[model samples]
Target: MHLPGYPFESRWFTHDALRLHYLDEGDGAPVLMLHGNPSWSYLWRRLVLALRGEHRCIAPDHLGMGLSDKPAAGRHPFTLAARVDDLDALTGHLITERAAPENGWTLVMHDWGGPIGMAWAARHPGRVSRLVVLNTAAFPDPHGPRVRPALRLPLWLLRETRLGERLFLRHHAFARLATLPPFGLRDRLPPDVRAAFLAPDDGREHRLAVQRFVHDIPLGPGDPSWPLLVRAGETVAAFADRPVLIGWGLRDPVFDPLMLREWRRRLPHAQVHAFPGAGHYVLEDAHDSLVPAITAFLRR
Candidate 1:
């Protein structure tokens, strides 16, 4: 498929035997864009084109999400922690080569990307300069409706059942995002792009990450990511003292206005723009307005 406006690039970090796929373009300060579940670096296509001219935009396809390699369960554990580690490794590699300064890079997060990217930022508080959040969450459960009820099933069955995998991927929420009115790209993405999103799972035997991602929801005690999320919450609170911009789509079924309200409560000083007409894919729905707002925010 032709990913016009958004090209592709690759980077390898030997420390973790990790081959990271990212978009490295433009110049000046660095802006790292991280996407949420079911989507890949492709999510940031418009954002990349908008920001690259003024900043070095780096958007990576999380290990199993986009164009990155998808190792089997025994070979790789696709947990939230593992995802954070990958981000750390990639950033460390980039810094060593002086691709970006350790303290000036901005973070752009969406969906599950909030936790993964914020976890890394919490670990290295000094490295993150600004935060641009888009309908994502970083703190503990906000008492909102969980998006994936099907994920609550048994890990073995959820991962192993071909039917289950297909169902989850083709769920209404995501499927709608990919084929919605304004920004649906079902027709635009080639078979490979679509396959890249689903091919990581070869039945239950290789879907450890997807299973773990579902199981790791830090709703309460005993959650594996609770501690990290707590620390991330604190980091977000502290980071709020810096510049923060939130662009939201109110019509989103998941991460709706409630999520935006939560962010507003936490960061009262943040610049927020809410789109009541748009859906979960705020970038796509409001690309024309969002890109300019983001650019202006960065320039300020």
Candidate 2:
């Protein structure tokens, strides 16, 4: 299903016996967009339309997140490593099929996309030409002293207990709040756009990935994903010379000023833009300024 203003056709690729959904638009240098939990390629629709005239835009819905096939319990493991591998497989196939640009590619990432995309970028540094980071963290820095005090309770509920599964999969609480205003968005999302993000995970089975994503957060050395996240941090930090654009929303409660500061600390050369009026969804909040900045960056 397509959003009203986003008229691009949906494309599919096979990975690990599952049919993954993605969008391939326009041509030239490739702009690979990876989304976070409870969101999909639909998150990058505006950016895709803005740059598709001169750039190839590839946005994928992590399996079970968008129109991609959602496998049942025994079918797949929704871990951080699995998400990165999905991206690797998708890009590998695109390169083989001549869909990827001949040269290195640019990445546009947000939320969980930050770590997932960075994980892939970490492994394939030579193929990364540039990066556009929006309200996401590639490393596990949230546990530091800068973390919001109130954030702990919700995280504990969502990450360490059955409440997360019940709330996300059964009640659809996350999707409902995410697609509405007051969270990632400053204003209420358009009906079609909200629906597009929610439609793919309308069922418990399809929503499993959403729950698992929260559960996968590596809070400490004992966490399952901690080692991988540390590796990703090292890899991302090594690409300091690559052109990087960090667009952030200062109003975001989750990835707030501290996260931006962390990014600045890591990628000292990145061009940073912080939007005070925006929230977690920087694209929706500051796309007017963001699109132009990204286009100019690509041209450079």
Q: What is the C-alpha lDDT of each candidate?
A: 0.72, 0.85
Candidate 2 residue spans exceeding 4 A from truth: 142-148
The 10-residue segment with the lowest total lDDT in model 2: 142-151
Best by lDDT: 2
TM-score of 2: 0.95
Q: How badly does each model clash, as a count of residue pairs?
A: 2, 0
Off by over 4 Å in 1: 144-212
Error of 1 at 201 (Å): 8.0
Tens digits of per-residue lDDT for model 2, 1-300: 556667889899999899999999998989999899778888898899999999999999898788888888778888899989998999999999855754679989999998898889888888988999999988878457343567788888887688776898899898788766677788887777787778778778778888888888777788788888888888888778889999998988778898899899899999998898888888887889988998889999
Q: Pick the candidate with the highest TM-score.
A: 2
